[model samples]
Target: MRRGENLRSEDYMLIDPFINGVAEFHDRHRDMRLDVDNMSYEELLALEERMGNVSTGLSEETIMKSMQQRKYFSIAEESPSSLEPCCICREEYVTGDDIGTLDCGHDFHTNCIKQWLTQKNLCPICKMTGLGT
Candidate 1:
């Protein structure tokens, strides 16, 4: 707050959170260890999957299975309207383009939505949980 001011933990975090986050991230990753010499191939794959789920939010299969995909169709045929681009990538959707439509009705390109789901289990636009939906 001032020159030679005492910093509480909260204050230090507020002032220098990036450095603290780096240290915390390093500490967290450093703790995940593998006994490669002893583990079998299957064990290694399982460990990798576990680590993947930890590093990312969900597995690809889970995302693919839980999220619904449909061919993009224009709503303009029903009424006057404009097309909106995919929220994540801001790319305009063409008819028949594979779209990931969440239960909340938010539409995104399939790849964009998959990438988003890999890191987060909720809808980017509505914050609805994928599993719940």
Candidate 2:
């Protein structure tokens, strides 16, 4: 998925309610895996109801604030010798690339870090809460 892209409703429907992993839902009547796209509107509604509410964690506003507070620095702004590649995307930082410094002192591409923060509030490297609770 690209940075800042919202997951589709179908993606949410496939998420496992008990675990974060995705699970193939079986169509008991048909004795086969549930095909979300092929299901009728009523069937979709019933499946959604069964899944119940799913939480993606931190609110948009909170994530935005956390993102805003992140220290942004480009390779041009800092010495290239001090720059490091973003671990999440496994891409090297370019001269003009903007990087966000997390509270844990780990740095990543701003977009990469923002994407990660949406699902988790912790710094990926240290697993420290970056949202300040």
In order of appearance, the predictions have TM-scores of 0.51, 0.47
* Candidate 2 to truth, TM: 0.47
Question: What is the C-alpha lDDT profile of model 1 across 104-130, one tens digit per residue?
Answer: 778889999888887887888879875
The prediction achieving the highest lDDT against the true structure is 1
Instruction: For residues 1-133, write the lDDT of model 2, one tens digit per residue.
Output: 5668897867656553435555656667895568998999999999999989776556657766765444444644576667566889988776567677677778788888878887878888888886664
Q: TM-score of the candidate numbered 1?
A: 0.51
Q: Local error of candidate 2 at 78, Å? A: 9.3
> RMSD to native for every prediction?
13.0, 20.4
Candidate 1 regions with alpha-carbon error over 4 angstroms: 1-56, 75-81
Global lDDT of each candidate: 0.77, 0.72
